[model samples]
Target: MALKYSNKINKIRTFALSLIFIGIAIMYVGIFFKQSMIVMSLLMIIGCLATLSSAAVYAWIGLLSTKAVQVTCPNCSKVTKMLGRVDACMYCREPLTLDPNLEGKEFNENYNRKKQPVNKEN
Candidate 1:
């Protein structure tokens, strides 16, 4: 089975979008407890918080996106933003990299992690 790759920015945006729906679902469930004001109110408050947090996440990723490097995907020719050493094209899911050394290497999310030197003594 082939593993699918996705753009990091797009993934985060999808997650934030899901949060809005989840919050709405929570609020909808609260309707069943209409007889109990406290339960209904508590659910409503939690739902609002979830929705608001999603907005915050959107804002944060938006800011970070502005700082990401924009590059044309060699495979699709469409411009896409990338973060860290390796990322996938937003439009085509093509693997992309800013580092020349990592070019042509198998795409791995682990490439983004900082490499730590091995402690031979240990």
Candidate 2:
């Protein structure tokens, strides 16, 4: 089976944006429960929590952005950030690798895992 790939940072940022929209939708629905003050208040609180969580996720993304390696994507000729040994370009979804040995190989998330050292003396 072929694997579908997307930039990790883009995927996470999309999720965070979705959370904000969902939180707004939930809060809008709370208006329909105007008869019960308690229920409406509870829904509002939940919505607020969702929005706040999205903000936290955005902040975490900022931290990750700092650690990710920035490179110019050959596919799009645009700069993008990569989190691991293998990652997709943010704009063009082109597979990329930091290791020369893995260049041109099939894209695999396993490449991101730490490799066991081989004994060169053997």
Candidate 3:
């Protein structure tokens, strides 16, 4: 069975890239409405906003890159950045975790969430 998980950073990067393309597509569509100045301008404005937001997302990813831990992926032996507690190798898609206790366990995104209290006998 193949794991479907992808590196969080890579996923966000893909989203950012898509946003740029979508913005450009929207702007292109605006050209079709040359006769309607109001509609064309509105589309252009929306497209510009989308492009600007994508830029902001890129900036956010830059900040996140600084916080992500850089480690050599054991599976592929390539350098990859990991965010949160669990992430996949950017190149190999091998699941990774920083927590020792969770090592060798099935990869789950929930591991990155806040842990709930476990009931125990005193």
Best by lDDT: 1
User: lDDT tens digits, residues 35-73, model 2?
Assistant: 999989988998998999999999999999999999999
lDDT against the true structure, per candidate, is 0.91, 0.90, 0.91
**Per-residue alpha-carbon lDDT of model 3 for 1-122, expressed as tens digits?**
68668999999999999999999999999999999999999999999998999999999999999999999999889999999999999999999999998888779888887883343743
Top model by TM-score, which number? 1
What is the lDDT, from 0 to 100, of the residue 77 in candidate 3? 95
Of candidate 2, the 10-residue stretch with the lowest lDDT total is 113-122
What are the per-residue Cα lDDT tens digits for candidate 1 across 1-122? Answer: 65679999999999999999999999999999999999999999989989999999999999999999999999999999999989999998988998998787678888898984454775
**Comparing 2 and 3 on lDDT, the stronger one:** 3
Question: Model 2 misses residue 110 by how many Å?
Answer: 4.2
Tell me how far the alpha carbon of residue 62 in candidate 3 is from the true structure, in angstroms, after superposition. 0.7
| Per-prediction TM-score | 0.90, 0.82, 0.89
Q: Which stretches of candidate 2 lie over 4 Å from their true place?
A: 1-4, 113-122
Which residue ranges in model 3 land beyond 4 Å of their true spot?
115-122
Q: Could you tell me which residue pairs clash in candidate 2?
A: none
